[model samples]
Target: MKEEKMRFPLSPKANPQAVITGEHYRFTVLTPKLIRLEYAENGMFEDRATQTVLNRAFPVPAFRKLENDVSLEIITEAFHLHYLKKGPFSPNALFIEVKSNFTNYKNRGRRLADLANEF
Candidate 1:
């Protein structure tokens, strides 16, 4: 098979101010309510937009990150995030608490734990 020229090439959005990275984990704050979490077993994270992610050039949202020896915390206007800096993601390892006037939403890492294993 012959190779064809690509119509649309991928463009990278590298916003260092919006990212928090560790040895094997990377968390990017895309918006006040949207965050991108990535894990690389080989310690290499993707920088360019992929087929699933077309546009990643979002304005950096307001957030504060706190880190301890055992855990990491990120606070934003819309939510609070807690992550255990252990091996991989677990129900007890990561959680998000949504801040709202109406209701409180607590999300455990059931699906996030699976994503870690795929790496």
Candidate 2:
């Protein structure tokens, strides 16, 4: 009896205050209306916690990251994100505004890079 080869377990862990990266995009808030968008062209990003995400110790909601030098805004507690730190993901770069029923919801615009699998 000698035949063993089984190794498949990964939990990279990503909660650096609810992650938010760039250079290909990678955002993860996981709460306050859930948020987790990732697009890696070659930046390599996969913080595990898949398989329907059993748990990730969330509870760091209360965001606000307004950057300069192009654009990059993120005000959570129910979304208001806009990015374009260098451009590539079009629809005017990006958008996500949904701060709890805006008088009949009408700010729709979220094309999160899937333009026929953008090259």
Q: Which candidate gets the maximum TM-score versus the true structure?
A: 1
Model 2 root mean square deviation, Cα atoms: 13.9
Worst 10 residues of 2 by lDDT: 110-119
lDDT of 2 by residue, 56-98 (tens): 6677788888877666778877878787756555566677787
My TM-score estimates for the predictions, one after another, are 0.72, 0.29
Tell me the tens digit of each residue's lDDT in model 1 across 1-119.
99998776555574789999999788988888888888778879878776766677767789999998667888999988887777665556777878874645435536544534543
Q: State which candidate has the highest lDDT.
A: 1
Off by over 4 Å in 1: 1-10, 101-119
After superposition, the stretches of candidate 2 with alpha carbons farther than 4 Å from their true spots are 1-15, 26-59, 62-77, 80-87, 109-119
Model 2, position 48, has a per-residue lDDT of 64
